[model samples]
Target: MSRPDLFKGIVSVAGGIMLPIDQTLLPLKEKAILIYHGSNDDVIEISKSIQDYNKLKNIGTKNMELKIVKNANHFLSSQTFKDEYLYEWLEKNI
Candidate 1:
């Protein structure tokens, strides 16, 4: 069977697969990166987020926060504390 050409141009790099966020060479200008991933996400693997967070820390990313919500799916429906967390983080950072 032939492979589907899904997200060809958008999710690719120089005719190859795009690297994950931590593996990419792009510079991040944000003062802080708040990544929230569900532990039970069915779409994206939780390992990817953990890897990214570790890589960010290894590369000395300032104010990098990773929150893993338990029992939440891809939409994080089980975790609804984003607003409060965001507000507090923003207040402290900005």
Candidate 2:
């Protein structure tokens, strides 16, 4: 089956998906960037988030954090809509 093209518009947007990481996140280095991804996520691979974290870290972002929910799916099955990690991040950042 062919992949439904979801990236066409993404390419048009500067700092959108599949674009250069530095271009996308460099401007937000001063901001606290908290990324959340499920380790067992099938919709979006966890490596993508890790790669983003690594790139941001390499760029000297000190307030960045990546929380990988173990054995969780895309929506983090068995967890509340606002999970603990999210709550903690919000409390710290906000």
| Candidate number achieving the greatest TM-score relative to the actual structure | 2
Tell me the lDDT of candidate 2.
Answer: 0.58
Q: In model 2, which range of ten residues has the least summed lDDT?
A: 7-16
Q: After superposition, how far is residue 39 of candidate 1 from its true place, in Å?
A: 0.7
RMSD (CA, Å), candidate 1 to true, equals: 10.2
Against the correct fold, how does model 1 do in TM-score? 0.62
Count of steric clashes across candidates, in order: 0, 0
RMSD of each: 10.2, 9.4
Counting only residues 3 or more apart in sequence or on different chains, how many pairs clash (N, Cα, C under 3 Å) in candidate 1? 0
Q: How accurate is candidate 1 locally (lDDT)?
A: 0.55
Error of 2 at 56 (Å): 0.6
